[model samples]
Target: MSDQQPTGSDLSPPGESTSDTSPSRTAQLKRWAALDTTSGALLLTAATIAVVWANSPWRDSYQDLLEIEFGPAALHLHLSLADWIADGMLAIFFFVVGVELKHEFVAGTLRDFKLAGVPIVAALGGMIVPAACYVAVVGIGDPEALGGWAIPTATDIAFALAVLAIFGRGLPVALRTFLLTLAVVDDLLGITVIATFYTDTINLPALLGALVAVAVFAVLVRMARRWWLLLLPVALTAWTLMHASGVHATIAGVLLGFSVPAVAMRGERMPRTEWFDETIRPYSAAVALPVFAFAAAGVTVVGTSGIIQPVSIGIMLGLVVGKVVGVLAFTALMVRFTPLRLPDSIGLRDLLPVGMLTGVGFTVALLIAELSFEVGSDSHAAAAKAAILAGSVVSAAIAAVLLRWDARQLRDPDMNRDGIPDVDRDVIGG
Candidate 1:
């Protein structure tokens, strides 16, 4: 290192900072975005921090910060910071989900009913039973709580996959793929519930306007494939109109996502659907998901009856017990009673961890919890969110244990359940 005099260009005047931060800041953001599609460690950390912050002495600041409002009033885009994150940033997340779902239907595993039926049936069972469990638990004490029956029905694909990736060493690829397909279906169902049941009064004109915007967006993405960035304004318009139409703004994301062509056109290595996912999914995972978790999971641990509350208890039961029973029972019922066949080498034993994984509903469940109650039902919302967090953690822990056991079992060929060596799977760590 050399001792050098400060150059005039390097010197800043008092009270003024030097240099453009945009480039460095933009690059740092890109680095952070790259972490999204990984193990979801960042998302979990955000939730943990939110819980800690909410219970801290400065808890009021957390709430206040979420409630702070901004945006252009001209287009009625003004909304609280939390609403923006939930409504706007989460729209991005849903868009990515839509793209994935389209790919599955068009070219991926869902293209074959025989291969996809088991997980599809399992996804249905997983969703239905949890909602049933929630209703049973919450209905007796509070019939109104039925609105949140769908809360525990969702599976946080990112969180679930992260757990599996970490602990499911030597597991069959089929199991991982099963979870992915199940999650994709679960997301579709979750989006449907939001659109069908959760929506309030409709604004026909605005909804029509949103639909028109989505059509334009669809056309542009295919025709103007080389100018994909130009679709942002149209996408924003759809999101805005959807918000104005009393529908969840995130649905706009789903529509926009669905509008994208799934197959790669001639001369392209991958479809625009994948290209869009590659571009936006990282930011969705790293930024939208964690921020949403932080905002949604900051409920007070002791609020309302908390874990003891009917809604909270119901959600926990639905996520933990309901998911396991639903997946196992419904899957068995379908395979045995119906013509739907389980894929090769996957036994009933294989589904235990799969069911538990579905119970990890950290992200979407919280969104539903928020939508379940009317604004100002703070105590109820708090209880529901607390339940989701607790349920997800418990479910994840259970799944990890089950997965590790299965992996260990696979390590010993003698412990194989079917008395046959499976050639298709990798042992744990393979």
Candidate 2:
């Protein structure tokens, strides 16, 4: 089935519309993209600085800051800076994820399952087999460690999109679509993992409070017709309640994201000059994602002493090796034996390295590390951080190089695959 493109103002939620042809609309989009890129660049720079500082004489200060405790008198919440990023800033990331998820389901790619099949299958392949491999090898003895299994189950959306952008027009548009689809499914899996595995011994009061918030949010969403400013405050309240309830605060972010009404602004008309979604959604993607990336990507790496510990080794290997093997192997088998053609632009050769790149699990890996790190095992947590750093660096470098090579091939202008020209090929390769 061909994917349904969102169109016509009738689909607009009541009041959302704008003049798409206006120069202002284009300028707004450009601004949004600029914000995304700048924030993304900052994140990359911050991560690099963290790595350098962790190894330098400033390493002590770096470690100290992350470990420094700050909280209140009566409530007495204590956590390191790293923990603050992992558990706190990350909730915002999940909140965004929830928004994206809702958008897709309501109006975007997953609007039809057949159109969504390729990436859905690919993401499932990417997640399930790696986890099975991890559990089979070392999962027999400790069930607590089972929480770590979900670590390899996600794809880093920012990194994937960055890789695609580098390839430019040499890749297929379908590739981006497929990758986006895959990441969405992959994130959903990660959410399930957190909900099912990473919770503290359940607290009834907290759960009840969460349920109440969810109910109230739903009621507000349905009844309140205006594009309400209440979203931010309500989301914050939900985050606090989730935190207090002992549920992962990040989940609260997701729930709040869902509650945010996508209702059209008041005094709007169908098929108007501006579309509400196109206007507001890109800001989240371009600005919010990159900031989250920069804030979450950095992990101070000092003292090589315990950096190569067993848990670290497992995580690194799982992300670097496990993702590639599982995703590629499953995809290969599916295309080979079944009717689903390998995306027309990707042959077995090109697919191999792309699979390898999917292993570049930076953002998701950090999230899983936070979820896995139980109380008092700071060293274990540190090891997980080190492993993510090492694995992501290696995966990103290798994948970037290989993708560049493939992109060059697709861009040669002289070569065509099975009657398809280079320009068309580039879009697919993306």
Candidate 3:
């Protein structure tokens, strides 16, 4: 995912550590993956390098790299390097999203209608306002550009959570959970937008095949615990058929995720969902997302004029300003009027940063942009990508500042936000 290139050479001298404390390479990786900001930093670094590569004098190499295609052509599998990452690797990320969604709905606080309704409703508002902003902005100038209205409707869960975890250290866990639920719901809505508004054609026969494979996978997974290796082929079959069916291949991931049972099986001590999360989420975070970001974010600079075009500006406005307004406004109204309530020690002030965090729409926004505009090199595509990058940066920066402020001003050790202080709270960055 590092452009398939090695990164950040180590130059410092080796430091001494206690023999007992020294961990295995796998252990180190697992801990690093758990660091909360590691994935976000990796994503940002890959994206920054991609952007620089796209703009540099050796930009031709960048294009060549992306154009390199592989996979069997007969099975309709021949695809460019970009397609491989966007459609293939990105599915792993969505799979993680699916797991989180399923877990939240089945066993987490989201099961409660009143508690879940806040984020669910806020997510809808977040999507609606941004789409409206995009349509209003571009439709007024270049009506054709309105096709990209869904670009800013997504909130990259990883990126948003990373910002919150790093900068909002003292904030209650409720805030993080709220954002997670909200972002997951937001992405679900975004995927719906993709599946509904963007898909122009369908192959019903292949779609049916995909559903069957998904159902088979669902049953096979729950039937036994050691059936994991066998499940791979079924999952791939589902993905391939869904891809051929003209529906987005990533939907297969969500479907497969929905297939996994939340309850523990016969011999399992924990639920399969948690097991899958522990097993696969690290890869998704470290590899899948960063790779997708690298491929999605490599928008070449054409000129300032195109970069700041009306369509581009509209995307930026929708992502930055529109997401904040939508999330904050809907959440405020919900908390004020309805029986739905936020966790204790959290207030509207807490939601201000959360609102800003929701605006950090990077990976999913970029995906929608590609789907919105024509594939390959196009001025409109370039402008939309540039705008998404810009908007995401602005949103993350503002959210970080606000989260830091909130942490300092409203520091509370109530990690779970249940009005009771958690004595076992983890030390920040430990």
Candidate 4:
């Protein structure tokens, strides 16, 4: 979390770790943070454009564009632009996620169990409560809609961090770190859910082929030679096989990422994994994600009837109400009952807004909604999209207000000017 060099040999590779002296690595991370903020803006713009196009008179054109397919048909690779974006481009995003997760678990804050426990528990609670809420609302009457329980369990890292950057200028650095850790854990859980629950019928031969390709990729990367050229073909082959194996092709990206070494060689200035993330992160954030949002976020609202459907209400409640309640309650329980400790700069009150901000489940929620139901066709899918958009917007708005107020409280420790910091008085019910 401090961006300091890692200490343990288990985290570092065979040679000396370059984490401390790698100026290029630090610069790349800075660039990534800056681009992450910009990408959030771009994603919102793309989603807005999709909504307008979907609701406009030329909505048919949007559907036509999404349906256009142009991949090689012989290999069963022919897919719509939307499918390519979801399955191919999104792999790049998940690859970056895998890199970050590896870094966290191996050398970052998560390497210390004490430091990792809080966010990990918070993320688990955040995921479980929302899913429970969704099922409670939609499962009894419509079991088919239960597939979308995972939709609200995600936290859009870019969007949530963008809001923090915009509204949390004077807040403690610990808050940002907490949010990052929580989001990272949230992503890991989401990935597990996708791989475990969403996978359909397995193709044993294709899956075995994918494993072979991945093994070859791992060996090639360990050689630390000009493996990119060789690995590219191997990666593609693996992806194709995974696609054919009924497992999501994006899992291939995470697998390939984990195969890369997290520590630098004796002479190298940066880890291969860091370099790869630096190079590909921009493409994923700026182009891949925005394109996916454009393709996936468009939803035609049929009327009030569609908007009030159980799926719509369930997603909304799961995101807006369930997320906030779950994150805050679980975090408080952890601090009170467990050994987890909050940073001195952060207090119980500070987490309230952070919990609410976790509700802004935009990008991944939309992706899961698409996976949950028929895309661009099912009435339920349309309602789910509408709910995701609406719920994200409402959550963002509420978090903005709460964060702004918290910022003010940080700036002025005493609201009534009667001395005795206002936060203590409020907490004590004075």
Candidate 5:
């Protein structure tokens, strides 16, 4: 009956060590890195199409397409294309995120609270500071704009990782690991905010139904039975009820993901969580995320003036300025004043670019923006979208330059006669 999990490294066959140099381990890492890069490219392409379609002469068609609604209204399923992308397809993406989060907690660096505390605290500072910066700028002038404060608190991991994979070829592994951890924690916080603040009136009966379904799903998963045919309907039912219950449907994805076992049973070859992740991750990244980006990122910029509104300015500053300052400052303070220590392979200077990369608040930020403003508030929505796009681009540019500089610095002579460069050795060992 116990679902308690072993660490990730323990998922390997009982006789094999989880050495990075192992052919299987290296191949797995390469596959994941390749997938990340491909997803990033897909996201960029989708985002580009959205922006172009939004501003082109055929913009009306784009709007019409998104607004086109179908499905059974009686079942509370009638929704626009945009809504389907956000509420339906993005659930798949979040499910993968949930799997990754569970893996990290069960076996990754986050398995140790002392090692994990740095990024956890950095994520907190990252979220809080951007929110404060956003509110301070827009909330003071227009109280109604305060709702958008959460928009800047998100960090788009796919976009950020794309930048790292391109520019951080020779950088320390610890840097990428740190960024991944930070972004995951940030997503957790953003989801919490959505479930807590963005939700309106709740339907308690529907919510109770959803919770019951979730419990059932968890029990079935714990049994290690291949009941996807049955479980799929239960999952969808939970998601539908959650949607009807005034909670975001993606939360259903996370809850369902948590139910899957993270460790293999005695006769199993792989953990169910890892197996599910490997099977579903491609669809999540290559299909679900791109579609969501295409639906969500299209915002017509009227002109430069639209991009300079108080709300837009607040979003831009919060993302580009507040994120970097908050992450770096808090990380430094913790290492200096507390018992926490930075990973040996990474130094304070390295975090500057890492902090900057955290500023790319693309996907989830867009979702928050949508929730923050009324549909009729076209001006505000357009402005905020412009700010998110601009801030992310600017942050990526800065992070690229800083990472290149760091790579160059790592080229210094290696006094040790080891075949591997000192920097590489440090990164791999760490």
Candidate 6:
């Protein structure tokens, strides 16, 4: 063999570079996972800083910055930069959610009913039971508290994943997969709740405008084929229409997402590249989520009364109690009555920790917190935030410990791996 070995043409035919720049799909996935990890760390860091800053001597400036007002007189609208960021920036977040929902429904996890059933049921139970708990405690007594119904209804994927990672080697990757799938579906429920229960007075003209814009978007999305560029203008236009209409602007994300071409493949051929799915998810989860967390997590609780208020109590209870009962109970029933079975990698003991992690509802909870106090009730908002922060932290901590311990046992290798039957790992993960 020559010392130089085989060069491009010799190694593989023409057009092949020795440099390997074609981008290994595995490498890309690893990189995305790493970024997700980092984003989660950043969110935790930002949240810590927000709590510290809110309680520090510099708290006034922080509060003032959040409340600073600025807007135009054209439509006669004005709100503090904080409100705009919390409400407005969050609409984009919802847009991302819509896209994800569409993606999942079209070709992702929700693609097959057999695979989708467990998560779908778990997510529904998780949401409904929590809402029921909140209602039983507050919503029924005073319907005003009903806005808080969506408070405990979501699971933050970042936080949940991070907790799973902390458990390290022992986690039966199946449990992680199940949790992720459940969170995605739970997010869908949260979005529907926002659209159905959260709107104010509907402006028909504006609503009609939004519908027309959505139709235009559908046309553009279909015509553009795999073109990612087309989505930008259409998304903005949808946002404008949604904002003008009485509908929550965040639903625009769902619309845009649904309009995206998820079924790009037809018959034997791969449809165009899955650029949007591959590219957008990492960008949203890494960059958009952290930025949103930084802007949204800042709240002042320093000089205020330390007692956990009713709103906070409701949120904390709804998440901590509701999620655990809902997920476990539904899963238990499925395992008992139906032919469905737990992933071979998971054990009966592992369910509790995973269930605890399901209570980490940062993103959606924050959005609902904004809605619960959109009328500018400080006590109500603060209480809601406190509850969310507390519940998320407690749930994550408990889950982390439980998962870590479970991981240790899982790595033992002596444990039986019966009934697995070697199905594709992604199916369970989904």
Q: How well does candidate 1 match the true structure in TM-score terms? A: 0.88
Best-performing candidate as measured by TM-score = 3
Candidate 6, position 271, lDDT: 20
**For candidate 2, lDDT tens digit of each residue in 317-343?**
777788777777776676666655444
Put down candidate 6 lDDT per residue, 1-430, tens digits, no spaces: 0001122123221222346745465545535433445557867887787778877899767677777888764642376766566556666555555665666666666777666677678888888888778777775445666668789888887778776765534455566667767888888888888778878788888778777777777776666345546667767777766777877777776776666566653331222123334444455655567666765677677667733655677778889999988988887787677776665455556778878888998988888778767523555777778788889999988887876676556232322233545343332112
Report, for every candidate in turn, its global Cα lDDT versus the true structure.
Answer: 0.81, 0.61, 0.79, 0.79, 0.80, 0.67
Deviation in Å, model 2, residue 344 alpha carbon = 5.9
Q: How accurate is candidate 2 locally (lDDT)?
A: 0.61
In model 6, where is the ten-residue run with the lowest total lDDT?
1-10
In the predicted model 3, the residue pairs found to clash are none
Better of 2 and 4 by lDDT: 4
Candidate 4 lDDT, tens digit per residue, 252-336? 8888877877777647666767666665666777787888889988887633256678898889999999998888888878887
TM-score between model 6 and native: 0.83
What are the per-residue Cα lDDT tens digits for candidate 3 across 1-430?
0101111111111121234444556655755674458889989999999999988888779879988999989778899999989889999988877776787788875788877788888898888898899888898888977788888889988888788878877666667767878888898888788889888899999999999999999988887545667799999999999999999999999889878888766755556676566567778888999988888898888443567787888888888999989987897788777777665456677878888888888999999989988756566898999988999999999999998887778455652244566454332333
Better of 3 and 5 by TM-score: 3
Off by over 4 Å in 4: 1-34, 302-305, 411-430
- Decide which is better by lDDT, 3 or 5: 5
Candidate 5 C-alpha lDDT tens digits along 267-305: 676677776676566677778889998988888764435
Global lDDT for candidate 1?
A: 0.81
lDDT of 6: 0.67
Q: How does candidate 2 fare on TM-score?
A: 0.78
Those runs of model 3 whose alpha carbons end farther than 4 Å from true positions after fitting are 1-24, 302-305, 410-430
